[model samples]
Every structure is written in C-alpha cells, then in structure tokens.
Target chain A: MSIKDCLGIQDEELVKKSLENIDYFACIYERYEKKLIRYILRISSFSYHEAEEVLQEAFVRVWRNLNEFDESLKFSSWVYRIVHNTTITEWRKTQSKGKDRKQDIDDELYKNLPSNLNIEKELGRKIDADGIKRVLDLMPEKYRSVLILKFLEEKDYNEISDILKKPTGTVGTLINRAKKSFNQIADKENITFTV
Target chain B: MENSQKLLDKIQKENIEQRKKSEFAAKNIFFWTMFTLSVLIGGLATSVLIFAFGQTEFDLLSHITHSRVELFLGMLPIVWIFFSFVFLAASIALLRKTKKGYKYSPVLVLMGNLIMSLILGTVIYFSGGAVKIESIFAKNVPGYQSVEEKKTAIWSAPEDGFLSGTIISVENEVILQDWNGKDWKIDTKDALIRGRVSMRIGEEVKIIGEMSSEGLFKASEIRPWKGQGNGANHVNN
Candidate 1:
C-alpha cells in the first residue's frame, strides 16, 4: 500500500493519538507563530500590553481546547479564526476604553523601533499615528477586520473567509468593499492613504 | 548635508523598526500553537472518546475501553487541553497574591494533576492504550494514542516497517519524513524535506519515528520544511 494508506483514519483514533503525543502541539505551535503575532499586533494597534494580554487569553483557549479541532477544516483557517476572535475581543475592549493602545517607546516587540513612528512613507507625506488611527476608527469594524487580515496580517481571501467564518467568495467581495470603505474614510479625513 | 543624510537614515530606520514591531513575535506563535493544540486535542479527544469508549464492539478490542472522558484523554501525545486554561485562570487568580490565592492554589494544582492523570491515561491507552499500557505494550502499539504515561511515546515507530497507516515527521526544512505502516528510521540525508519545525533549538521531534512520518512519500519535494529561517529574524528568546 502507498504510504498514505499506511496510517489509520483521520477519525477518532487520530485525535486520540494527537493528545497522547504532547509534542504534536509543539509541531503545531511552530506553524503559525509569526502570522498570528502580526495579526494580533495589527488589530491591537501595536499595543504590546493588549497584544500580550490577548495572546495569553487566545492561547489558553487554544491549548485547553486543542482536541476540539475538526480535521476536515483547514488548520490555518481554524487558527486564524481563533486569533481573529481573540484579537477582535481585545480590539473591542481597547476601543471601549477609548485610549491610545500604543506600545511603550522601548518595548522589545518594537525591535528597536524609533521613538517617532515613521508614518511619513505615505505618498511622500508623513502619516502620523493620529491620522492612521482616525481613519482606522472611522472604518467599519467589518471593513477594518478585512483590511487588517488581508494587508497587515498577509492572509489570503480563503484564510480570511475561514477566520471570519464567511464564504470564500464573500470574503473576497467584502475585502474589495472594505478597501473601498477605507478609501472613503481616508477621503473624509482629507488624508490620502498613500500619504 | 551630512546632518540631512543622518536625519533621513534615522527616519528610514525608524520606519523599518515601526513596521517590524507591527509585524510579529515569539509570544504570538506560542499562543497560536497553544490554542490550536487545545482545540484540536479537545475536539478530537471528545470525538474519539465518544466513539472509542461509547460503544466499540470490536470484540477483540474490548479491553481497549474506558469511560468517554478516559478514552478521550487516552490517545495520542497527551496534554490536558481543558486544564491548561484552568491553570491560566488560576495564574490570573494567583496574580492577586492574596489569601484567596492560597485558598485556590490547591484546587488549581489538583486540577493540574487531574489533567496530568487524564493525559497520562491516554498515554497508557496508546501502550495499547485502550485498556492499559501493560496490555497494549503486551500485545502491540498504536502509532497515535494520547499520551497518558510519561515514559510512553504517544505514538510508536519500530524504526523498521509497519503494518498499516502513514506516519508524518518533519525532518530538516527540506525533507519530509514519510511513514507507511513500516517501522523505519528517517535518515535526514535521504528524506524529502517539507516545512521546518525549528531552526534554532535544533529540532523538536517525537521519535515513534515510523508513524510520526505524517504519511509516507518517496522523498521528492525540494527543500521540504525549509523555513525562511524566520525565527532567526525574530529576537530569539
């Protein structure tokens, strides 16, 4: 038999096997470390505090419920869904607090990022933190989520679909609409996104 | 002119740094893995236990039985998906560092041990794991039984050949280990690599080598687990 046939079913046995194999979790942890952090950072607006808090909460949920994973669904999709949910919850709380969720001037997550955020690369003009936040706040939550997952987190449409639990095509269409919505906000703010 | 050049360089550096911060970190990866592990294990454990323990009339496999909770906890590489959260919650609780913490600490520790036992049960289950380690090891070993006992591997590979099922293990970033019922040692030199598990802390692998192959394949993929060495880019812990 081919190597494929050699393994048992991806059914209950597989699930059981995974739990007994604690290192399996480590294998999984390696897969999405960067993308998730990036997503969390973007949603949390580079707020190390909020991102750290959300990270713990999110992982706690994931670790505690690892077995709940449905094999048929793509793992990344399920993962993104977790991060998205965790991040959204975090983001919402931050929004509710109505405080600037900025990282400390010298947090390690900044990787030696300068005291001044370089928003100037925009269309040869500086896009200050205030400007970006203004536009981001004005954007609908749905639109903002899409944009962040797409651009900031670098997730594809299908992944975004899974994360958002929407249809693949719907995610694609919404991303387009989201971009448009972002532009509208930028226009209203009199801030060119490129700027 | 020099001062202007310095200013521009600093701005550029600041921008790059800003972008990096907005990018990602290790903690992010830790949590993602933790969550996936929990959800996958929890959901799968529940599913399998429901099936394995619920009503398996496999006849010969009767000894391979336990309560649903036991069965669920008994397969694969064991870890308590449910209890980690409880501990984390307790960690938060303990953060208060009050008499309340003293009161709740024992309960948290008990839960931790409970999870440990539950995970260990799965470990024992895989040793044939369905019934008990002595029984399972007495007869045969399943490639993937939840880890219940510390000494047992959640899965087993005889390092030679197998009877059925494919095993998967990630070798060097370029080679993918393939297991097909046959027990075999994965020689990284001859393997077809897939994605990398780690580039820094050497490699973290479970050596039931055969079944862990993640499904057997003729090594053909180029640069299998070869990561962009992204972890190196991050500030390593």
Candidate 2:
C-alpha cells in the first residue's frame, strides 16, 4: 500500500517513521508539495517554476534537518516555517534580479477562502475575485501575509505566529490592521457584488 | 504530479543526512552561552558605574542645603547612567537573539535582563569588583574626569563649604587628601569634633569650614565620616 493510503497516521508519526527509513520521507513531500506551492506562490508572487525551485530547496532542508525538528511543534507548522524562510530568501534574490512575476491569484485559493470570513462582509458589500486580488496586492507585505495566512490558509493565531515567527499578540494586531486596510481599500475602489 | 515524484526521487537518490541531536543541542547551548555572557558583562558594567557614583564626594543632603533641585540635577551622573543604559540595550538584544527568546514577550525579556543585571550587580558589589572596575574606567576612559570634576567643584566650595577626605596627617593641624586629591590644611582649633571624636591619620573625616585667604580651611566642625548617611548633622559651618 502507498504511504498516502495509510489513513489516520499523524504527521509526527510519519516523521518518526521517515527517520528510520528515508524512503518514507517521500510521504511528507507528497503531502505538502501542493500546499507549499500555493503558499509560496501567494506569499512570494513566484511563478510556478520559481515556486517549484523553492519547494525543492525547502524539502531538502527539511529532510536534512529532520532530527533537529522539535516534537513540541506540529510537523506541518515546522515544515511551513522552513518553506516560508526559503521562499522569502528566493523572493529577495528575484527582486535583486529586477524580475517581477504577475501576482495572479490562484482560483483554488480564492475559492477555498471561507465564505463567512469578514473580508467580504466588512466592505459592507461583496468584492469580486479581481477586486480582492487588487486590494491584497496593494496592502503592505506584513498585512498581506497575515491576511493570507488567516483567511486563505485558515490558520489560527498560534499557528500563524509559529509560521511567521511572531508573537500571537502581534499576529492579532496584524490581522486587525489587515482587515481595516482591506475595508478601506475595498471601499475606495467601490467594489460591489453583482447578482 | 510527475514533478512531485521526481522531487521524491531526488530525496531518495541524495541519501539526505539528518542533523545530529547533539548538534542541535550545541547550537542552543552556544546561543544561551553568548546571551548569559552578554548579561553578565552588561551587569558588571552597570555595577561599576554605580560604584563610581557611590565614590563621589557630592553629599546629597549637604548639597540640598544650597538649592536642592539644582544641586541634585548638577550632581546627576549623566555619563555613567548613559553607559548603563547602553549596556542594558546590548543585553536585551542578545537575549532576544537566543533560541527560545521569542517564547517570552519583549517586556518579559527586558525585565529578565534588568533582574539579571540587578543580581549580578549585587554579586559584583559584594566581591568588591565594582570599585576596582570603577577606578579602572576613571583612569582609562576619556571624559571620565569631567563628571567627577563637576561633583568635586560643588563639594569643595570655599564659603560654608563641606569636604570629605582621608586625613593625610594630623599634628598641630590636619592635612587631608580632599575628594579631588588636592591637599587641604584644616584649622580645627575652633571646631566641634563629633561622632566618636578620635583623630588619626588615614581615617576619613568630613569637615565644614571657611576658606581663609591663606587658602587654609578653618573648620567650624569635624565629624568622623562613617560612609554615607552617618555624618549629615556635622555640616555646621
């Protein structure tokens, strides 16, 4: 049976098994590849190729540093942190090269956002996907990252803090600021939902 | 999907190495060691500055006998205090860089640095290293004399002035090494000697006196200087 076929196995348990048999590590790569690609794409505005390169580097780092992973943290959070750092480093290098990637909002990510989240309601109206994308791109990186992690990735404050390497209170503050900025931007742009 | 498979195959082909737990622990140990050393050095620096302040001849109570606020403000050790704050900031920055530093809030980390400095300061005080370090700074660091000189000028004023110094000699009169290391001849014939009134060479004494034209200090009273707060009542000139 494929490792993916093994249901109910926690990521932590997978890490322990992968420590003994390196081949089992492929399971971790398989599980997180798409999610990480999406996250890196959204955060760094990387094209799929650039995102793939970052993903490969991030997985390599995780594989080499597996033993250094603290069991106290969720394995997913730890993996995402490595990916986050690697992507930011890649993003900086890309910036230095004066290459800009169109920050095309992934339809899957946009669709996956919870319908009940206030990003739409707070505008006192609904914004189309293009309006939402424009508002997100206009905001500062700090606020944009928090909004993506909160609404897009659906991470709670603690997990967001772990991934961002910030305190939970700081994460809360960033979310509040992001929401306010989003409301103002949407209002300024006059986004209205069509039936 | 094929690309994901290739990445997995790459991991298997490379035989990626897992970092040793000892190495992880070593990194943590190294960060903590640097943090602790920073705090200790910062604390010792703070204690040294405090000791220099303590060794000053500016008697707060006596200076208050003039204009309280001006004297207090003038005698404030602004330079040493600035140094203390700089050391504190360095310690806090090091603490934040530690591996588990982010686990504590910034305020908690700052308070931790302060408490560490306080504890280390007390230890340095008891070990008598504070005074030694203070003297070293005074001699070696530039502008060290400026703060001290201002304090001595305020303390050694000529009229109704107060001075505390080590008695260099005591024959018919007392020769003192004053706070600024200058010699002062005190005429104690008309003075009231208080507080276990025994005179000896090398003992510290506080004298309240008038400055004669001959540049000798005519004492109205002399009291044994029993460190701080012991001879406040003796300033009777």
DockQ score of the complex predicted as candidate 1: 0.01
TM-score of 2: 0.78
lDDT of 1 by residue, A109-191 (tens): 33321234332321134444445555656777788787666654557776676677665666777777876676677777797
iRMS for all predictions? 19.3, 1.8
TM-score of each: 0.35, 0.78
For candidate 1, the TM-score is: 0.35
The segments of candidate 2 whose C-alpha lies over 4 angstroms from its true place after superposition are A1-6, A112-127, A184-195, B12-16, B56-87, B127-129, B132-203, B206-226, B229-237
lDDT of 2 by residue, B1-237 (tens): 565567667876886667897888888787778777777777787776666567554654463356667666666766657766777787677656665565566777788788888788878977998867767777898867554466455556656467767888888778888876889888877677775546689888777677784458888767666534343243323
Residue A189 lDDT in candidate 1: 73
Per-prediction TM-score, chain A only? 0.67, 0.87
Write candidate 2's Cα lDDT for A1-195 as tens digits.
254654577889888887886656777787787888999878877888988889999988998898888888778888988998898888888888997645667666565343656555544556556666777777777888888888777788888877887778778888988888888876787654442
